[model samples]
Target: MAYKARLQEFSDTLDAEVIDLKKLRKLVFNGCPDSGYRSKCWKLLLSYLPRERKHWKTELEKQRNTYMQFIDEMIIKPGREATEHGGLADVTLDDHPLNPNPDSEWRAYFKDNEMLLQIDKDCRRLCPDFNFFQCASKHPCSRLCGKNSFETLRKRVEQTVLQSESVSRNRLGITNMSAVKRKSSSEFVPLPDGQEAHWEVCERILFVFAKLNTGLGYIQGMNEILGPIYYTFATDPDTECEEFAEADSFFCFTTLMSEIRDNFIKTLDDSQCGIGGLMDQLMSQLKEQDPTLWHKLQEQDLKPQFYAFRWLTLMLSQEFPLPDVIRIWDSLFSQEKCSTFLIKVACAMLLLLKDDLLRGDFPSNMKLVQNFPYSTFDVQKVLKKAVEISR
Candidate 1:
């Protein structure tokens, strides 16, 4: 009975002509019923789509088309052919890869490769316990169908693998050079035509994001953050919404990063808005809520940085499994101030584990917080406790 009542509430909130965002947020604070509801709610919560129902189609089309333009301009390398619309005419002699000029596109492309490599590494290993990211998407990037010249990131990775003969490494402060025979070119298999793996889509979105935001380009744990958002949208039941999940995910992620970019910027680490400041806020909440636990942590020198750094920065994505992370995000995104409320959630986690935390010393408590006991964890209880702490 309660479930049906909650379902009706969400249906009413979402079905309204112009959504009452406050009502929607309150309903979503508990978590969406399924991916279908979650998909629409996340887009609305992230401010990717406006509240007006009539404008949804136009807004989606406009933003999606703009995203494709970004892919065309940024992802695809320009050819040597002269086109009617500024091709060779725009090229300068100093624009080659070896050119010392800072403005060279080739130079920027190479730098982007370095960032792409890191993004690929992190994304490939994303949520190892779950096979969702590894599975091929039912609805791939159909928008990229005709652009055969454009290289998918998977192909780029295979090409890189085939080209590299060996890599140098340092072991125990000693330079070790060894011949590493990587897989042959023939060993690599390609995905079926018109189909790309889910991780590839994630990699492409992050790459585009890094290109657009040059200031704080491609931080490592961003893959963890993007994983849940992409999963929610990509798994959406609406075929139309699922089809353009990539573009939608990109815009939503961009909006989200704008709010948390300060956390990723090192220069602003100690600033009030950065991750350091966020952890400090978490510690303060801990002290106020459970002084004994907080003081014991202080006595054992269990700094928040040792554990809460990843929690606060990644919004607790690392501490929990994918499903729990999504549920937690439901609560976090629904709030007016997600980051500020995250401090309360962190406090809630400590208060729930107060007995263990207060009894243990530094090493045990550190390990406990670093690798959360997800096996017995309850997402709803933690969130309910988080609300209590907030009050």
Candidate 2:
């Protein structure tokens, strides 16, 4: 680490906790170092850190507390009774599920179920091979509530209530929660079947995200997107223990989603900035660099989105192991270009499997591209190829 000039700058200013943004960016252009360096750099890249290092502590606290407030107000409903209908007060007699009122909040609630269910399924299945998402939290977590207890938030979470209709009102008049009451991870008590704790934390984060970003609402595959980020924070290096990984990760995920949300928004799919347009750009780039494969894929009707959509949206999480995904992210975060390197990487991957792809028809090609070509799982090698293509 000391061998790198920018890293040396980071070390020299360790006491002040300041490093040159341009230098830091240049240094990590290839990728950040290990967890301690990567996590900190990620915070900076995501704007979690202010330009003045002195304000880092204050800024981080305020943002993380705000994220907690997001959970307290949005995920957990107040003054609402928990019912069998997913925890909101029953759709009134006129506003019931059968109600014909198109403008009814109850009607809207029911409609949101399709979106919520899709998010739930994806979040639950996110990185199941890992025990962190699969098993349970090491300790039972405390709920986010007011000074005393988050009575409303607790009930809603306990009942899995994600789509309450009174979003505007609840958001406007959120019950005040104390920032000082933030609990350290050490405060948690373990449970026998503690798996619910981690999932619930993830659940609350996504739900809060949906409520806050009404334009995008919750979208499928976001869980996969959030997985590596939370994992990196939660499993930080011992020197830099993260007592509030959940809150910090929430902020980081929000910043990340803001950049990539266009990919998930269906209405924006065809816009110039949308995923579809980017796919067009990617295909064009591939044609410029690897026209043979591009023509072959188009001949077989293997459009970019068929495979690249997941590649771009989840930051390629689904196609690579968690560690490899983290490594790929290091490169993505470093590049100054609009992450076209991701597309270049994908192109390199296909070229790596050019022989097999050329031999197979659409189905085999689809299957091969959908999964990272087993021969190209070495993200390091693929990344090297990706960089050469980018150049």
Candidate 3:
């Protein structure tokens, strides 16, 4: 069968208690290696099976404990004593302890490992779209919630959002206000009713992001990014076949989300170690290639962060067409090492518009910088050029 047909078949079979363990094994092995759970692939498969819910819950708890141990180990290096405890710790503690200020730590972490952390957060939040085990109480992941338990916090969020029908509907904009306003000249137009549909989309997106990035929780901007995905999937379920294909889309999205989460949730500190270094390299190259533009920006006291931050952060989601975004993402998944390729794409985009950039006025140049791909640059061409440049 063709790939889409096979995917549809799998979706149809989602409720089946008797899974083809062999096929399940293949899927897990194929997908889980890069996730640092290669050895735990079998465990993940077992945990997902219908009969294993109780055992899965227990195993998941054990996994959380293991995750906490790993974090503790990293924080207190070997041969060093933990400050809290007198005994030798597994890893060295930071010279400065994590402060109570949430934004400070988040900002610092994002600045350092921008790519890795964003991807890490995005992946965790969106995994297993319907039954998200990662962010639920089932998983005791300290990396996400810190001291506050994930389950308790998640339940509170659900209750707060779900309890008030009026709030949920208004928040989701389920009502056509313009249409309602057209019919009535009332000062306060009531919101249209469709609470269940609104909540379904909201919850699914929330669950996806929450499960994918346990550390970050649900930030405000996440909803905006996910809005399009939810709309595209759920708006016309009958026509889009989303109802029939929900399971497949869920799994496919889970796989895709795993690949790109780092781009979304990173703080400045988190990028310093990985793509952060690459960003520095790219900036240097840009300076060498376009010193005039580079110097112009410096003369204005404008840093690359002002313009290029979103590009690096969201993997061009805000800039490119959704179709183009999907294509680029497909390429990202195809390549084992995609970071360098992404940088090359960024370079290609800059190079493609070099002529227009050189001729434009300061304001125009700034505008071009602000709206990357500026007018006339082709995303597909740039992506293709990026692949070639990386090679």
What's the distance in Å from true for residue 94, model 2? 14
Sorting all predicted structures by TM-score, with the top scorer first, yields 1, 2, 3
Between prediction 1 and prediction 2, the one with superior lDDT is: 1
Off by over 4 Å in 2: 1-17, 78-116, 138-148, 151-196, 238-241, 336-338
Q: Write the per-residue lDDT of candidate 2 for residues 1-391, one digit (tens) a residue.
A: 4557756655554335566777666666666666367777777777767767889778877876786566545543223434554334533355454667787655655554545554554555567677676555443345222232232222322234332222231111211222233332332333344234465556657766887888888866778778888777767774333556677788888988877788888777778787777777778877888788888998999977677777776678878888888888877776554356778877778788888888999999888887775444587888888878867
Minimum summed lDDT over a 10-residue window in model 2 is located at: 169-178
Q: Which ten residues in a row have the lowest lDDT in candidate 3?
A: 172-181
lDDT (Cα atoms) of all candidates against the true structure: 0.79, 0.65, 0.43
Steric clash count of candidate 3: 48
Q: How would the candidate models be sorted by lDDT, starting from the highest?
A: 1, 2, 3
Q: What is the C-alpha RMSD, rounded to one decimal, of candidate 2?
A: 10.2
TM-score, every prediction: 0.89, 0.77, 0.45
Q: lDDT: which is higher, 1 or 3?
A: 1
Write the residue-wise lDDT of candidate 3 on 1-391 in tens digits: 5655545544433324554545544443223222222212222332322333346446444543543443343232223444465334344343223544553433333332333332222333332233322222211233232542222222222222111112222211221111111222231122232112222333433554444455755443343345334333333324422331222233334444455455454453247543355566567766766687666556666555555555654556556765455445434443444455566667677767677766777678767766776346666677666756655
**Best candidate (score: TM-score):** 1
